[model samples]
Target: MRHWRRIAVTLLPLLFALLHVSGVLHLQVLERLESIIYDTRLRATMPGTMDTRITIVDIDERSLERIGQWPWGRDRMARFATELLDRQQVAVLGFDVVFAEPDGSSGLASLQRLAQGPLAASPGFSEQLARLTPELDYDARFAQALQGRPVVLGYYFTSDRDGQARGVLPTPALSRDRLRGKPLRATSWQGHGSNIEVLAKAAPAAGFFNSITDSDGVVRSLPLLAEYQGQYYESLALAMLRVATGYSDLSPLYDAFSEFDHDVLSGVILAKGQSRLLLPVDPNLATLIPYRGPGDVSGGSYRYISASDVLEGRLPEASLKGQLVLVGSTAPGLVDLRVTPVGRTYPGVEAHANLLSAFLDGANVLQPNFAPDFDVLQLVVTGLLLALSLPLLTAGRAVLLSAGVLAGLVGLNLWLYQVQGLVMPLATVLVMALSAFTLNMVYGYFVESRTKRELAALFGTYVPPELVEEMLKEPERYSMDAANQELTVMFCDMRGFTALSEHMEPLQLQAMLNGVFSRLTHIIRSRRQGTIDKYMGDCVMAFWGAPVATPGHAELAVAAALEMTQAVALLNEEHHRQGLPQIGVGIGLNTGTMCVGDMGSDIRRSYTVIGDAVNLGSRLEGLSKTYGVTMVVSDTTRALAPGFIWQELDRVRVKGKAQAVTIYTPVGTEAEPLAPERQQRLATWQQLLAAYRAQEWDACTLLLRNLHAAEPGNILYSLYAGRVEALRVLPFQPDWDGATQFDTK
Candidate 1:
């Protein structure tokens, strides 16, 4: 159970991070909000102006009144055509009117007989019948004017499924049978022909010039081709284009922008590279027509001659040379007015002129095929980059990387649009980058804060005051599995602390221990170079090397030990003066291999050292009492502190050991180097140790007696003398080594 708990703690961070990243929980709402945000952005960023040119030719109410009602007589239409062809020159003429029924004025008696059917005897019925009989037959004269000339006619389609189709339709420009397989919304018309005889004999080709208005009444696109009765007929604009370019087949492309050359019909291509004008439309296939309004003389970018003035021969000959002329009514009451940005009552014919001008000039807005595809690509790239980078970098670095990714995506999109005429979605990519960055940051902050809280929870009381400084630096390092490294370990305990505790009440004893440990803890923490691993009642185990590394760990540890010994001395003096029992502390120092890391159950842990080295350090602390000294260190620590002054104590095997380990005491002050006299005394002690290890009992005792005479209260030298006397009594064996032993623990 304990092991499982430990493992769970170790993996908690990773599991939490995975949950946040998977987005199976709270992230759905975030994505939903992001989509709304992107849509709003697209609406705000829509362009104000389109880069296309189109024109309209209006059949106004004035033209209707001036040219004799709706259908002028055939002779008058022929005269209108002569004026256009002989005087004012036009590049092209497209008719916006259709004549589905035949002219009946010449057959007046037959029309009157047919009119005698339903309400023949009603009042004023005879006068009405007479008026209908004398009406002019405009079909004949219009046919004469169309002879050997390029003219296009207009017709409309009906949305009603059972539309009334009248008159024979003109021959189809393309087949519509294959289009039937695909499900499509088709426009059905009541009638097809605007002129039967006139279109058949006069015009070279005719087109359906039906303006399929949308519910909103905007005209953003024109259906260059449509299907009817298993046949596809061209529009009036398309027929005129065909005449101008001399092409027979027109293939429409749906995805790409329309393009044209000098040969309009053959050279036009859509988004899909088909040889047709692919117009971009909405769900309704309609958009607003940004019209430039009507011109004064019907001579905007093209030549427009008045019908009356042209018939009077008031125009010059040079102006009409080899030009395509269009004859249409321009009178106000003709009801050919339209609404546009430039004017509300603009002529409709000018719209067609604008389209011609736009095609001729090659100015059009190209909606590319790669835009939506690029948007999807941007989303994938942004999500992937953030996912990979966020986990591996610091908060600041992650933020910087996220910013770079966003900038790159946005910059690339802008370049594609500006340089290659591609329109890609920028909002999705931007949102992805920002959202990933923000979420990762939020997760990181939470993780870091949790890690700090964990550190404080586990190590706040167990670790030494000084180690807390490093823990605060980047508390995450104290997380489970913090690595063990080389370090200096120190163990300190109050001598006769058990006896002192027994003499006082439990509360009083705890208060005293707390007060003493508190002061010692302050000293350790103020040094800020090591952590006190833990306290065993009045004992402290500290080490320098985990959480942070220190190069002079041995030197610092030794300095701290010496300062602690002095503090204890002052404390004891104060205790004695107050008639309280004096407390002595013994400290053991060792520099060796030990594992310093978080060690314990998941619920409770301590940052401490463990290994054979730690046991040796504890054994050395016990030996401090045997020698009646306050501080002692193993030979390992002596070697590590090369600049510090150390005096030899003895060479003996500590409890639970067969191998003898040498111990020493720090005798140096704050001064730079040892005095000559102290150096000489240390040299004598080194000789004494060599003699003792060689089993020269007399020589070791002689040196120790001299050391005791020089410093009579030196318990370290006296203890060595007692050891030398005891070794002389041992029975010699052939395999027996000089290494000593401690029988008691």
Candidate 2:
């Protein structure tokens, strides 16, 4: 039976994994878990560090309202670039906006209309146009401005069924044959076309500034290289890099496509004599962007000069010297919005900034090529080990071995992340652990469930037979052991429980207690601050800072005490009209170090607390009877519960204790602790106690008389006055201890 159970344990996880792999079970839950892990990782990584250095040159709503709607003409853009190049002196410029069409500002179309008018006028226009045809074009001025400057054209690629290449591309240095027919992994974007003529004429270098967003609509990658037919073409960013480097001899290395170990290691090799720079590649041959958005109020680490300011020469030339500058619009009307992991409605330019920052800081996430193979290996090894070792070893030994395997898996993944910048899914290994553990547990449950008739008989009195069977298979989260720690203990007892039970029948009494206790239990468990440590008929015992250490246990205990008192009052009001006996409870709370956990034997376990502090709390609950108070607390609890209002009661050593622990009855607050009347009354009372302590009978009598005259209805003052009279008759003793012991519970 034991061997079969062990075998069953090993098979359970394997079955689950098979179900998961075969798509018979939902994998969305696992994916969601991964998302959570990634979110946690992102939060961990973001603190005290900024990874990207990209800033937005915003064309804000104000700019749009101030300037006009978007799609400003080429001449205006020419002026914007001239300002950046001449005044701000930016490093390089990449346009997020594409100029796909010619400038329509000049009256060439109107001139054509004029040409078809009068014969003499048309002949004159033809003769004049032949002499200055180049100068007559409206786009000629902008083209002149872009001549020989650092400008990259923009274009989009498509894979639509009807989509066809309409223009020529730069000569391919890396052909399809060289890449072993590996097509450039371009993002599939369906577009009408691009302003190829104007953009191509304006910029000498450009990349296809298009982003590949995931199903979640988050842009995470940008294709660096795309293929058309047998030719390899670069992205807008890549084109800009090529232009910057002046490298025309680009070549793709097929060996770079393979996974090293379990990580993806695709990168571009920029030819430079005998050396090359490896630019990291994404699954779509795009670069993973590491973005830094515009949080720098004072031009953090990087300077940002506006296009208008640059045009006006309001920037220093020295700032732009030897800098890699990105020129993009931050204008709201220009519509360059993008969503990222940490932000929504972020500027598209920030992606570029992040990519640049990642490059500068060497904070790139290396793609894991061997991840798939590694996962397979993990599954096989873990499956086989559990299948064999689980049956061979004892339960305890099996657990230890499983723990060791789990630890090894975790350690290996963490080491990869720390040492080689590789992020392996540590949770996958954890899945294996859970699978193995669950399989073992289920096997035990199934085997034990069949032969637990004796165990079922024992537990049937307290719980159902089904529950007994369940318990035999899987013991609930309970243990019979003592754990000592700081805790807040609460004991609530109904004042009139004895009277209520006498008047009601057995069923009625049961129903009444059940109704009250059920509500109270719900509150206790729902809050999760403490547990209902069993009901002592009418009294409830609850303690915090146990099972789990709650730092604010004292506060929680007091708060719970106050709420219970309020709830009991409301319940008493409801019972009064029903002819049921009205109920009230006196709650006593004490916060201090105590031992908590289950304390009974294995067959009959009960969760409870046992310590000196817990005993004092109960004693204080009984003391509430003598004090004529509803809620009572010890000095220890009062000190911790500073937010509450408390009135100090006389110190007394309860039965079986030498030291007097000061007990307090919370009578609420005094608005002014030193109001004239309260101050005078307090002073007179202190004088009376002092005289009584000194054995000055006459002085004590005079002070008590004066205090009683001033505040006759005050119970504390009356009690103290009476005590002074009684003490005056007693003979003085050399060893009259100050400890007052309570004779009753």
Candidate 3:
């Protein structure tokens, strides 16, 4: 039974891992960790080689600085297209840009408006404008340059801003009829920013340049195809590839070859009669970006030719001949930078180029559709194996087994990733295995120390559980035998509990008492680290510095007393809301030498304290009601705990103790200073005590009145006033101490 129990305990992590893998539990940190792992693997194994076949014409900072700011004259753009295609002789040209609106950079609109309105009758203005119209029309001139060229313009899809769209979209790679009534799960967009009708017709082939950003805002993949308005469009890389390969027909290739085709789109099959190529896609109809290197020319990834250099004809003729050229901007002002695994400020255009190269190399890495199901199976097998076996083996063997399991899992995962380009989910399985090993090791250690726990359960009633744990570290030094130590003791009693018990039923009173005790006990034991002696009726007795000698026991007890009073005050708040009587607590703290140990009769031995100081603490608790304060601290406690602001109450001699002890009520901690008026009251009360102790009854009388008036309905002041009035009649006595002697315990 215990073996099975240990196994079950160890399997708890695996249960949660299964839920995480199955999507029943979504942990963002787990996803983030998985991405970090994937990123690390990618960075470690990337091919740092450049692709000479593709080139980037970057509108960089130099180009912007030399040729004026962006949205430059479309005539300039037309010159760029003409130069790259005619002079540079690139095989294919793609613009990682969208011309959604007509360009007015040539000032043709103003010229046309002048010809129509103010300058309509100007000399030769209409005829000259008609002759220069073809040259001044920037968009038309740019479109004419792109006409009949093998160019694929890039656009992007957006799912924001209410899906509002502008301009015209290119013909989709796959129409709704091509889907054969089967649903394909691809990235879907609400709208797109496509090229204008004139440009779209001039270069009819285009693809979206939108990159798929992970939850961590990282571009790890690009959708090979996206869906919009029941039609599927290809990405820039896919379109560029198809144009280079004689415009192949795109078809979905599922995993299985049945009529239903396995219900999974594994990849897209591009066929141009006898020349077929397979483009594998993940579940998102996306391909993982096999980054060749860093996205800069210096990183040996791709050739980056500045737009200004290209337009100025700085490059030798045919320098980039037969290469697929991508026209985009790399300037930060262009807002085309992306956060990617290789670098933080990667170029968005380079992401598409990376995917294009991955297409050419056929080195796509993706998680299969059976990933989650396989993860579940793997988790169960690895989890149960570790859960059941780790318990039977020794510590050394267990460590070895756990280490071996981890190494084996990692080896297999890396093997599959490197050999077959499969990106299996390794985070959850690795984490589950580590958690299982940790839980098993912890359980084993706890089981081996059962004797200590048994001893703790035995002595825990006498001392605190914390003390018991410390005591076990050196068992020979600690025992239940009596020992004398300077400790702080407390006696807390509920003031209105007697009245509550009279009106409430037994069950109700019991519940309220338990609730009150629970809160107060937590403050004393957990917060202050004080050991509870016992509870008697509505009173609880606890002491500090017992089995484990704590030097700051008095300070701990004082803080605990203050919090216990606050807890009762909060209880009274709920009582006031419920229309029940508000309750109060009186806690008394005393510090002195006391005998503490497990002491009782034969069959009912219990830990308790019995000394003059403990009895005096109980006596001080009763004095709280007489003085009308919540807590009373003895001079011993006040002296030890100097971190609190103190208000001197009185000196009193209880029935058991002959020596008179000064007591005080805690005003607040040093962190909370007494207000000005209260400080004055405290100062005046000190003088009143001086007058009364000096046998100056007349002076005491006047001070008592002022003190009572400062605090209306103060019992301590009222008590002193009656004492002075009664003492006024008696003759003044010398050698008199101002200690209020109590006759009862």
Candidate 4:
């Protein structure tokens, strides 16, 4: 029952996180973190190579400057399209722009106005105007250039202004009747900014170019299909892909499990002749932009040809021949740049180019439809591991264990992303695991505070502290009966005491040992609130989370251990001043389930813990000297603690213990970040360690040399370096698990 309290407290964080994942609760922070992580992973694994197949006819600053700014007369646009299609002989062309208004650059509207009013009665004026109207109509010329060619025009959809629409929208990819009243989670809008009627009729196909901006205001994806006026329209990129592939049909692919899916679509399929292409989309009918690299004309993802150059034909002959060109603007004044994962000022047209290339290459990264379930599963598993294990571990061991689990989680996520092209939710589970550990530790720290006050009032100086600790208080579960309980045990052994006793007089030695014991005992009891078991010659044994029932016994014990180390250091400093031999201390801590009670012979009974956990703690104390560290904590203890930086010592199978346990040496609290030089060295050492474990002897050896060069005096680095050398020459051992076996305690 007592253990259940701590367990429930530990499980609180996991429960809250589960709620968040289940959508019962919303955590904006988690969502933002997931986005940031997604961006990072996307950028890291993107193939930064250029794709020559798709080119951007960039209406860049240079083009805008040379051509006298954007919306450059429709006559020039006709020339631009003619130059690319007829002169350059490009394979396909798509516009990442719109023509919603009439082109009045030819002064034809003014001439017509005069013919309708003042010049109506003029002699032969209407006749002369009619003769020149064909050449003066610029919009007609532009439309003529696009007519019946393999060109797709771009437009945008808007949900604003009471659904007011402009111009003519392109043919719907999926008509309303095709849906048959089924539901879809596609992006929908009430209004649109489409190409003019003449241009829309002339272009064989057209699609929208509206970008999808995430909550963080980054353009990470664009809708491949969007809903408007009860019909679905394809994106410009999708239209281009279909044109290039010569696919003539588009259909929605519904998830077979429609009853559970509420008629939501799984993806869309395009088929023509014997060829077929499947494009997966999220609930929003959007697909992530698989950016090749950064986005501008200089981003190197795609070749960029200046619009002015394309218009004036100022290039090597047939340079753009056989290329698929997307016409768009990148001039800052044109406002086509977007904030993307690859760059802040990413040219919007390149986004379409990237998408088009992805469509062509069949390499699209998407969030798996089962991501919600996967997220919940990961959160539950990780939370359960931390909750069930942390209570029986010390603070240092808790931190180490949590860190290991976190690393595993991150590695697994990256694997699925790079290999499976799946975007699973990571931050919720990550935050839940971390939060559970933190709250677990915090619960232990604050619990049972009133126990001390009650004990003090009941028995002042008569009863032993241990006896009052387990009062069997009414309605509470604390007791003195022999029973198993999770606990943290400590062993602190004084070094150099034997030599000091030999040199000093018996009376002086007794006084020195007693004084040292007093200081150490004070640290354990008054400072860190621990229960001392007994004094064995020059060593002191203690335990936490016992009769008084401290929830954070491991952390309390570790803090006490750290304080004792500092006390010894101060003692050595005083010894130096007085010309006496300086003494040292080594502390070991372990946390596990143990039977603690008053158990001894009738003549001399005492309260103490008895179990393998206690034995392991003693063994760890002896290892402190081997590692040249003040404290050595078992993996369990290390995992129970949080917020402290730890340096991994080793994984060893101690004598009398078949199971190998990882060990760690505490450095300091996380409040003080490591120096840059130390951080670099630590990073190198970690890399070297990973290589050694993986049996990459060559890389391991090289890294070891670098580590040795940097930290020549580090004994641990030298030790591991020797191990790497020995393994380098050894024959392959399939059973090796990177753990060192020790025959001695």
lDDT of each: 0.61, 0.63, 0.86, 0.84
Residue 628 C-alpha lDDT in model 3: 87
**Candidate achieving higher lDDT, 1 or 2:** 2
Across 388-457, the per-residue lDDT of candidate 2 in tens digits comes to 7765666788789888888887677656654665555555546766678767766666754454564455
| TM-score, prediction 3 | 0.60
What is the C-alpha lDDT profile of model 4 across 1-745, one tens digit per residue? Answer: 5445567777887888888888898989888999988899888888889998988988888887788967888899999898888888888899999998999988999999999999999969999999999889999999999998889999999999688899898888888777848757788899998888999999959989999998898999999888886788999999988888888898888765454434667689999988788998876788888899987767788988888888788977778888889999888888988999889988999999998998988888788577888998898899889888987788899889999999999999999887777788888888887888888778666764454464455443323464465443421344345689999999999999988988899999999999999999888876777778899999999998766778888888888887888889899998889888989998999999999876778686666899989889999999888777789999888888876777888788888899999999877777888888888887787787677778899998899889889878777777887888788889878787788887887
Q: Which is superior by lDDT, 1 or 3?
A: 3
Point out the higher-scoring one by lDDT: 2 or 3.
Answer: 3
**Quick one: best TM-score, which candidate?**
4
Q: After superposition, how far is residue 156 of candidate 4 from its true place, in Å?
A: 0.5
Q: Which candidate is the best by lDDT?
A: 3
On TM-score, the stronger of 2 and 3 is: 3
**Residue 487 of model 1, lDDT score:** 80
Model 3 error, position 324 (Å): 1.3
Give residue 110's error in model 3 in angstroms: 2.7
lDDT of 3 by residue, 1-745 (tens): 3366568778999999988987899977778888998899889888898889999999999999999998778898899899999999998899898888899877889999999999998969999999999999989999999999989998899999699888889888988788758767888889889888988999998989998888889999889889998789999999998888784688888765223432458888999988889988888788788887777657689999999998898989999899998888889999999889999889888888888887788777888777778788889999999998998899899999999999998888889889998988888889999999998888778754574565687797666667688777644345577877788999998888778988899999899889988998899888888988999998999998876668899999999998887888788899889878878888888998888887888889887787888888889998999888999989999999989989898888888788989999998888888899988998999999888888898899888888878888998899888888888898868767988889986
What TM-score would each prediction reach against the true structure? 0.41, 0.52, 0.60, 0.61
